[model samples]
Target: MDAHFARVLADEQDDAPTPGASAAPPASSSRAAPTAALSQQQLDALVARADAQELDQLDARSLRTLVQALERRVRSNALARAKHADAPERFLESELALHSELARWRHVAAAPAALLPELAALNAAPLLLGLFAHDNADIRLDVLALLAELTDAEDDLADADALAARRVWVRALLEHRLLPLVVTSLEQLDSAPGVEDQDEEAAGVYHALQILENVADLEPPACAQLCATTVVLRQLLRQVAAARRFSANKLYASEVLSILLQSGAAPRAHFMAGTVATGTATAPRDDSDSSKRRKQAGAGDLLDRLLQAIAPYRKRNPASEDEEELVENLVNALCSVLLLPAAQMHFRRLEGLELALRCLKDRAQYVFSGALRMLDLALMGDARNCARLVEVGGLKALFAVFMGKKKAKKPTATATATTTRRAKSEAKAKEEELTMSILSSLCALLSPAAAHDVFDRFHAKFVENDMEKLDRVVDVFVKYLGRVEQRDLAGDDDSDDDDDNDEKDENEDARYLRRLDAGLFTLQRATHVLAHLCASSRKLRAYVLVKLHEHRIDMDVLAQILKEQLAMLRGGDSDSDGDGDGDKDVTDTDGERAKMQAQRTLLVHLLSTLQAPTSDAASSAVEPKQEEAKHET
Candidate 1:
């Protein structure tokens, strides 16, 4: 191949004359060239030779010639296929041949900039889009493949000029109204009979979706163009609704919906209003009246639909990994929507908390993690949700998961060790996260006025006569705080170890740090819950203080934890941070900081209340003063 390329370059060089003699070919040669244009037979032979092995030997000019020829053949073949449209098989065969030639063109025309002009000259966007209406599904699929190649962003191109040229070509394709057509084609293919007869429909949908995703990823103008074509959003939502559990179409549709929703192109009111009528194939209504209606309905409707979509998977085991992921995504969508006030109201109305509670029992960690997060959001500041949660026995359920005893205990003797230690580590991390979420939910519930009765009920169940449950709660706080204290005492010794530590030791240290962080979070939440209880109910405070004194629970530990947290908030040394563990920004660090401040404030209030005189003590002193006054009289 190298020799052939060299020989061709040499022949061109030999035909060239010195610059002073002539810059152009001789007039006699030019006249003969026009008359000696290749015949159809000669063109076929040339294409066959290039297709076999000579394509790589072509120079830039020869490559352009080959690409142009292939483009012309594609056009001619499409025309021929249309002419024989009555013979479906023959049309398909010709379409396949056309796609093969285009694929070859894409291969040899490695410089995308070189072939783009030829494609533009052929009006390739419309030509390819036109095939989408063909009766043969295979032909439509082939057209999609070609279009994907043509519109693909040339990321492999290193030169700025080439990349800009590719972008311009893409913009041209978009300008030619390719997005609307792609949407329309997907809608048609989705409704086509026997779409499942082959993989053609799926392939076409995948490519169509890819094109839309790519367009959406372009500059704001291109995204606007895509968003303006409202049919795509409507179709995508319908596809998402119709897709079976764990289907690829469902996953892609969800992803596209997320992108669209996040783009700020689709009005949140529209999604919130539940305006997407299921199975409706019409274009989206984006007018002021529609927006007004969406506002009137609010996000409640959307929250309802999301809840319904995810409700079925609440307790059921997923059939596959994909199904689990789909469930998690749906739950996440639910959580995102629940951020709205209206959605939170509707969530309680729709029994969303119950669904979340059921999901908390799911074997898939992601599914339950999402549920835990949603519960956290729903209970954040919504008193009505807290009341509903208590009504549904959510408090007990949370305690069950928090204590890891909802299901029967498995004795350690019967446990089997696994080879994958990482899996075990991950499981433990998830368990900690779950515990953290449960504590967060409890804290949220404890903060609301409506939750006072719920707290009373919890106290009656766990703290009334049985000190065991109460002690357990106290134990969680002390256990983590003690760990922090121990780590702090050993900090100086570990400083030298940190420098000499191997990778495995470093990893172990990191894990220990993470565990320490989780512990501090847990301790903070425990303190918050205790503070709330003490501030809300005097009798509860008296009972807790008595228990603390009886059990010799170190009030100093609570003070120490508060001091460390306060120091961290003030940007103190790493050694003075929570549990004396170094601080790194984790996802919930900001939230944790805020919670710690609130906990500190609450702790101050509780300590003041505990030390202040009780009503009985004041009344007793007043009685003695009154008797003394009577004796003096």
Candidate 2:
């Protein structure tokens, strides 16, 4: 055939297919053949029309016809170009334009399920693969998004689902000669220039990270290979480290680090450590959302593994504040896991309180709270292992929360008064309940020093500023302490009267009653704080009056304290404030003010204990105390 005739037939063949429809046969029954050859001038004309530089210049019908014709030409040319050992530069450019146009036209066309796979087959060539990492952020983004979407779908195991697509993508990334290109794309996007395009760069990094995150499930060997490469991974690590300082970038870096750790790529643990370091910073960059997302994603699991791997560092003195922060973050993360129902059970059986004790000593606020919470869980839930925790100073640290000088190295200076008060109050509540619970659990197991320490801590709070709080604290201690003393006193009573059975029973019973009376006195002291509470402020008096009316203190003590108050009030002495001399201290002024503050502080504590739902014995015993106080009043 002559070149002109062949060219005409090729044009007609290209015009046969329509967008979103299968190709229709032309008037002639034969399939139109390819152009034998084309002159440079003719090829250039076809190329210009294919470029469609000016859409308005063409008629609507002609534009439609041209698109159909170019679509066919693109498919044919792409195949030919794939096989051509030395495709011309112009042809290669035309191939890229056609591929980009095909991508755009996909939505317009009724894209068969097979279209992407077919395109991928063509594009996976060495020549086309380079375009995947092109400089145009939009092009790179679309390609990646398309690939990710195609891979993310669910179909049959052998189908074109996310798993299948991921496999193909990983295979190409690992076995293809395009590894350098992939690495360069990652780095380029990480340090990409221009603010106008930063979002795109971040997106590209995110896509790569998503793929990396699943590398273990999809391609463990490839993930290991990626980590094995010091040069490539080091840059990725550095990017992650830098990202932790920027709210906008930290998530992407954290995602990548999480993947590395999840896959057990030990080499990449340095990056995870770096992230932990950033998370624990005393003044970490205010990337709260990003940092939180990082933690939410997989940081907990990564942290657990990282800690287990380098436990030797637990005792190593940190090199700097940053290093300490990193250690603190790691401990926080591990303790969080330990508090999980499963981890709590696992560690309790494994005697994990030893490690937890170390965490309590860290002095970081978050770490301390986490350790304390886990210790409580262990003591409350694992009776067999409770002794182990008691042996380690868990009880002491908890008591310290209620009694010790607040950590001198406060985390921040600009805290609000309400926030500081509420925090201390919460710590106080936890400390009290934990102290009582621990003591009860270790009635005989406790060493003398530990028992004394518990008493000392309880005493300290009593003597400190807030006596009303001190009183309730002492009540909790007394409740448990009384039980211990009664048991001991009864034992002594039994030993004293050996053969006198009836007499011994009576004596022991009376001794038990005496111990119960002592127990009631502790409750009385605590209830007595309520009288001081009423005397200090009218608001406190009103609230305490309300609480007194609600749960009347034991009738005997109430009558006694009330009789004391009635005598003092009837005397009309100027000693109402309870601070003595009726010469009110400026810090302790105003009847209603003192009452309001005292009422708030008292109610604050009363409400917490009520909510806590302590041992049934403690709750049931409080009623008699309330009734006694009621009668005295």
Candidate 3:
């Protein structure tokens, strides 16, 4: 008897495809020939016996032989009759007998390890998708648990047959007909705190993500079939929302949502977004005014929920990470909406935009860049929106960020040469580069009058004794001026060359330059505001003068300083760069120490005695003419 059982099992094992082997045939077709021979009554009898928990009572060798036979039937699909074929009661009995025995086998702690693989193979085979839809919860959970194990096995990803079998089981699990039961199971798994240990719960979450990952790979039609059920969508959203607060579970929720979005479930995403938004609006906050407290708390709660939804996306993995990167793709799509004009309007009224911006501010560098790219898209061809960015203090905030170092320092090494290392030096260079980008954005939204107001509001903060921060702010100012000058230079160069080009090319280039110049001029105006602090604020005047005198100012930046000092000297009248003639009293001191001391004296004296030029009749007379020309256009 042992020899006979060994021979049978050996043959089946030999036939088992290597982990990387070609796809196996679907189990139903392969197993159908054997199942056709059994009757329904016989199957029912086996189920009764199995449910009666009689598996261990069978002779151990006999049980092993039965398991081998059942595995062969399951893997070959011999346990199920062909579609629309007359399924005999006996064949049904045989399949049920296999299922019942496997279900009861879980009670046997000493069951052979091979028994698990055999049972898992059966569950993941094509024949059991329908069987798991059986009304018995224990049966369904047992089947699902086994299938989840198979997905983690090597053969699952490599063998098309195994993947196909698993796919069918997943479909059955998520199908509308079985959604309620599956949802209940998911809910229990999620809510029952101690039912699963940390590792098991983590595995369960990973399993759920894997299922979504698999479903996402299917065609749109197949995806629609799975996602079309409202119950499935709502359940997924609720699970994700609830899971978002738990940092450990957040990644799983993120994975699921990513799959849903990538599967072309746009409405579902929008629906989830709406729920997140509404929830944020109604959540309560900690406050003394009961009404205000309720409102803020509700908003805070809602915001926390949204943060979870978006947090996983706050970091980027490389492009080769997955077939469909749900996190990156969803973030891209949602950013489009959030940065829209309509959304921006609401963003100001609620915490959504603020949260998004904060994430951009504090998140991984690539994420920050991506978020800014989205903002760039929102502002493109929309000058008013660009202006609105300035109104919300975006310029100052972005300038501060641009000057921040990319790599953080170790606290213990702060006092060493670590602060002055080459990495820090290079980072400073990069900081200047990013500072210009922020300036470019602000320049596109030029409002000379508003720039002045913004500068005054931040003047005190900018003039504080923190030299590092002050220098960073100054660096941003210089870069802003550079952007403006570059635009001006580009415009002049284009004008001279436009006549030599074809009319169409000339027109296009001319338009581009105009757009660029507008942006640059906006930056120019903002710099002018900062320049005002050089004379209008006494402490700032002294600080700037000291910096000006110091040898630390790079030569490339001296030109902007010269322009600013000239403007201050001229009583706030804007000075064109060409006016830097040798006639001015300005003198370059050669020694670094002497120059620094001289600059300090110059700035302090200038601030103390500075005065705005009177509005002479000639200048007052020209204002209306410029206004008239602007209005005419």
Candidate 4:
């Protein structure tokens, strides 16, 4: 602006007014070019060009000076507004100048390191964050736009100086309460009329979400900070966990909410506890009105509201890709919270199991996978949930899906590179997920309990229809077992494969083994399911032995197969990179090996259930009554 004034002053001519005849000067003589009062559009365009040009001419020192100048203009105009409220003439012009001056900083985005440290040193974050509440919506939005660009992540950037600079800048912003201001801007723009059309291309809500995601992604600490107060969580819940009209912003909020929940257990606990504190106690949010309305309209914790939002997809699949992804985000967020026992209890209280079962039954291509994941997480180790699952008749859907056709395994020539392989890998992953989910559900349902009849209804499924359910489960176990055996027995004909397995690198060896043994987990879970059924009921135990006999699988053979699995698991541990943490990969492989050991233990106990009578296959089918009587005698 000083340069513009200087140019205007330089162009002025000191022509004497004595030439009155020429005072009118043929009505066309130009004394000097007028300083054009730029419209907001022209001003914005001018600022856009100036941003690039000015920054190009600036060195580190010059950039810092430019920031200080903009800061002065902002504060000066703000002071004018406060002092001269009745006089628009005094403040209005400076307001536009400040808006333009702020607009020029956007070019710093391309190289934010120098500018951010400078801003922190100058204490410019409060001024910048304070602009969020300015009377002019465009000014508030420009603040967001600038912040969004400045905070944009440089994913490939590894400059030590830049990282340290960003850390300081972020700290400064948070110190002045950046998040609450952002939420206010978010609600204002989201609810404000005609703000979006100011630039049909730049969506304010999208910008707000991008700002959040970029910050959270660049710094894990930011994720905790974002969720520390309930304002962010509550606003995000309002966006995702309610029946709000759908938009891309809804999907984005859902994604950020998931990150927050998964960041640490504190956020998850807060969500489950429905604790809505502001900072340490309460935050001043723009959505306070909507918050109360939401509490009234939707009762229960955040988990329950998530269920309500997610419930629609069970019967009707997402109508569009955005909606599908949105629901996926909600389900993902719910899954993260479900890791807490309190969340699981809340979920079961809300009858969330029934909803998941319905979704599994709907098998709508879009809804089934997400619902299966949520259900898988929900019933993992919770007996009450599994009991509710059984009570709600979830078993039928699990069996129906379990009985679905097995994918064909055929040898094929390796193909040229294309998307088909990626698609196949995805499909294969989904298949594994579905199989594991049902396996888990069954294991949870038929688990041992103090009351004999607790699992009798579940046990009876194996005995009804000539033991159809049990036969199918065994077939699944056999099928997965066959896959494992075929691959293991093939014995690495590929020289590369053998080399990879011999490599001490855990990742490489695991990848090689994973490709060969895709059936391992399905096999483990199937083994667990069968083991539970055998141990839970003597009548079911007799049927299991007969089925194994019919399939030519003797007790010794079953034990041998299970032992081979254990050996594979144990041997994998031996291949760990000798990180001194073990030739053990103790953290990663311990749980899996332990699970396999437990599976083997179950098989061993099942094998020991009846030692005296396996010689006659026909007589192996004995009654619970006869077995009990013998025990009594």
Candidate 5:
């Protein structure tokens, strides 16, 4: 009932009963009067002195009691630390106990889900979160580590109930303005890059970021709040922009930034508005260059800030794998934001197209892929960018990548698992980046040129070099179609179900997705580039037709692609008799539906243009699907 203790006795009365526990208490002592909740200090002393075996054997009610007691002890010691700020000896013992009590909360992570909600009820979040400002750095760091442990998602992944408990704790932490405090601690910690011997502070910063990530995982709104409501995004941007050397925190800051931007439009619009000063967590007054950047960051273009942050590696080589990953993360985040029209405008104004082209041409392995991705997203639906791409020889750079895939180092026969995975991953990124860059070129170039730059010059590039680019595009189309056919064939090598039919169905669905990932998406993009080319230049179409006839590729594959696209376009309403949402980004899917309507229409027209197939295989492929499409429509 008093402030010195959390009341756990009455709180547990309504909790869902623990697994295997009875619904009611024994009748032996029912006549005796109910006991009042013990004070926090008394409960702590009792729990601490109890045998370890007795503690281990605690039932649900006892576990709830222990959680409240820890909350009380932590709160009291926190107050003691604050009161004795000028007198260290007076609070030394209290700080020590406070650390122990914080560690003690880890026990609750192992308890039944029924007891976890009591943390919110006991108001433990405020007391634990407030310690980030405690004068003792170790104590503050302990809190960060403790918060990360308590909210570890792996522990809560067993089922729905376990996950619900994690959400409760995360929401409670955010409810107490935890984001602002975490940002403040990051500012205070000596986490700046190039600092020597920052092992402790680095760990603190890592734990801080890990905590933020965990909180964001359980409470999605925390990400938006970090961007718009708190200065956390500014801190993260500061970390990213301040990198002079590779640090885990800097890499982590980039990862966290990517997560925030991808989370929703709030962060995209936050930086797309070109400022980080709007967050409420204002930094303390300082005049160092870094500090000045922080101060200027409030009004500076954050996209520019991000650009400068990444600009170093544009020419300079990365010293390590971590550095490469950091660059990729920043690039990914930038691309995510560029999905917005406003961001694309800023990207164009900043000459981002030229910079991306240079990076692409640099031919640096991981960074090369990143640069290509940057161009892919930046050029989407932006004619100014496309024109610049032409002016700056961007076509030469993209076409170079399109004509030849970026190569990853091959693993040796004795390669480790890590090496093998890295090789495969790099290869995958190379394929994806090349495919997308090609798609972007075709899409932007073939569309109507900008009113301000009315030179539909994309068609001209394909015609140059004796139709070399067009020929390469046809090769890519054939290559991806072969991959799709191979994977689809693998999917059809079915076994009789020795197990449940549901498992077989699940496997079929998963195989379908793997097929899409393997080459179906790339195949679709290739189809689009070819279709757009066909529609744009008669010579380009004729060149493509000749190349296909030479490859002897079945023309029915084009018809099959059309059917697949139609399915994806109608996928959002697989069971629908109603109109679907107009937002293509949300409704479009990878499989069980078509990915691109334009690709579908182009395939239909292209197939019509090839009405007289030179082979029966091509002829038979188009006819059945064409007939089915008519019925489906």
Candidate 6:
């Protein structure tokens, strides 16, 4: 027999039942007894029997019995190795075998929960963690892989007991302080020279990082612990800072950092302060205290790092889908940091807004959306940022896109008819979204203090460009409202159809409704910008009124929207006062009610501003009377 079988047989013989105590089952028996309550001796004998018969020949029951036996044997062997430190090679072999068996078992079903808690118990955690320092790189990799499996909480087990059992394993991992061990192993692996081949090293690193991610996902406190650790934070920062652009590690590091920052796990102020202190060497003023200087410097450095990470992608789009995702995560991290006042200052100083503007011009929708969002956040309640935006001619650049001068795409002539249509539809949708984003940014720029000057700048630009920008905004508003009206009319009609046709019609109607909803949202944002323009400047208001008078269709569109909104408000108020389905959807209608109120307010503001006489009109009228007096003289 094979040497592996010989050892199994020896162990089985040592613990086998006495011949007089119990009889062995007949070989002809089709169904074997369940092994859920098997003792150690019985399990060992089962393993011996499996070795003799070979795993492939075993029936389902026999295979399950062998798996239970292997779990018990691996547990006992790991414990023995932990108790007797002298036999390192023996312990290594046992661990290797256990990992192999576990991998096999994972292919069949969820891991037996008993396996992890046994390995992670006080006695076994140290032994299992010791594998990180094993002489063999492959062994260390295996240990990392096994731990990753042990800590994973994403397995979709339907059985409540299995899920509870899995949670037990996760708790054991946390209770035994395995997270710190995982971090330590990652640090060592990253610092150590090439252990095996390139693939092996990469695999090891990937598994280790995955373990950290899983821990963070399962336990918030563990994530907090990681964030609080200076060494770990530094290491993660280095990974992000030093990683080759668009590399997997860079993406992973960005994701981990995003989680840390967004979860409030790390003390944002402390981390920001640390970055500033380390990255700069400027001495504080004589009156400034060391703690204050440290904090200011840290906030600056943190902002600088985030911008630097985002800077690379401005000139170059991501090379792969993963890198694209990394760009999003990096942008989110930048946005989170920009929430700090100190960080916002650093952002402006670093010309972060310029980078975002450049990204907004990128072809990728996600990059553009992220950049637009960042710009919106930066400009919110910060007049300085709004000034900077105007200083950089951001207004002109955004207006170019807003006016549809910057075509999103030009389809190739070689495409099929359907493909061309789809491409055009996608391009049109993107154009709409981009226009809305620009309008949103413009709205953010129109704070009470900055509104006057910002409006003046826009008015000058509109006149210089022959009022094309204003015309574009008006046209978009009319077009979207018309589409919304068309959808409402179409929704009021019903046509009967066969089941299949009904389903298809329902799907098409659903898609059309979504488009209609998006168009209405765009209309709302455009109206907001129009309202701001009119409210802030009398000249712009006069121009809008003149344009509306010339385009009766546009005037009617705005009037219809206002009238419908007023009717809806009246209906909702009456419903609230009455008992007619008043309580049925009170919670659901609150948001719709608020939105209608805002739209009504903007419409009212636009109308009032347009009706008020401008200084230009008054001056022109006075000049004509002066001419009449001169003629009389």
Each prediction's whole-model lDDT (CA): 0.55, 0.44, 0.44, 0.62, 0.63, 0.57
Clashes of 4: 4
Name the candidate, 3 or 5, with the larger lDDT value. Answer: 5
lDDT tens digits by residue: candidate 1, 33-122: 233225634765676676757565545566557656656666765665556445333333344355556556555335456456555555
> TM-scores of all models?
0.60, 0.33, 0.41, 0.73, 0.71, 0.62
Q: Write the per-residue lDDT of candidate 5 for residues 333-363, one digit (tens) a residue.
A: 8888887766776677655776676666555
1-633: candidate 6 lDDT, tens digit per residue? 124533653565644333332212211112212322357447656764665546444444544564465556556555745653563433433543554454443332244543444433324444456656654455566678767776666663555665565566566666666767777777777777753335555666677777777776666556656656645555556556623444566678778777766655144444555555555532222224634653444534655556656666666666677977888787877776665555566567656777777776655444665676687667654657776777676875566566655545344557888998997776665566556645644553544346335534544554454666777777776677677767756654543343587776686557556655657667755665665555555656667768766656544445455455456557766666575653233433553455446545655655554345445653332221111211100
Against the true structure, whose lDDT is highest? 5
Worst 10-residue lDDT window for candidate 1 reads: 624-633
- TM-score of the candidate numbered 1? 0.60
Candidate 6 is scored at a TM of: 0.62
Worst 10 residues of 2 by lDDT: 624-633
Off by over 4 Å in 4: 1-51, 112-115, 154-168, 187-202, 275-300, 405-454, 485-502, 505-517, 537-633
Task: Compose the digit string of candidate 3's lDDT tens values, residues 1-633.
Answer: 224433543565644333332121112222122322246446655765664565555444545555565566453334233331252321333343445555444443233323343443343243345545443333345455544443332445566665555555445444433333444456655675653355544455445445444545532344444455434444454455523344334445555554554444343334344444543342211125535533553432322343344544444332333412434544554454443344444333343333345545553433554455445544433445555555565644554565563344332334467655765554444444444444434333343355434423333334343645557656555555555557666666756644645875777557555744445433443344344444344455456657655635442343344455444434422242345545321311112224334434544443333333323442332222111211100
C-alpha lDDT (0 to 100) for residue 243 of candidate 3: 32
lDDT of 6 at 354: 78
Name the runs in model 2 displaced over 4 angstroms.
Answer: 1-81, 84-303, 306-342, 345-355, 362-366, 377-380, 383-385, 402-414, 418-633
Q: How do the residues 352-393 of candidate 4 rate in per-residue lDDT, one tens digit apiece?
A: 777776776644356676777777777765677777666666
Tell me the tens digit of each residue's lDDT in model 2 across 99-203.
Answer: 445444323222323333343444342333444644334445545544444333234246546356446644654555434544566776766565224565666
- How many residue pairs clash in all the candidates, one count each? 0, 23, 28, 4, 5, 4
Clashing pairs in 5: 565-594, 567-593, 567-594, 568-593, 568-594
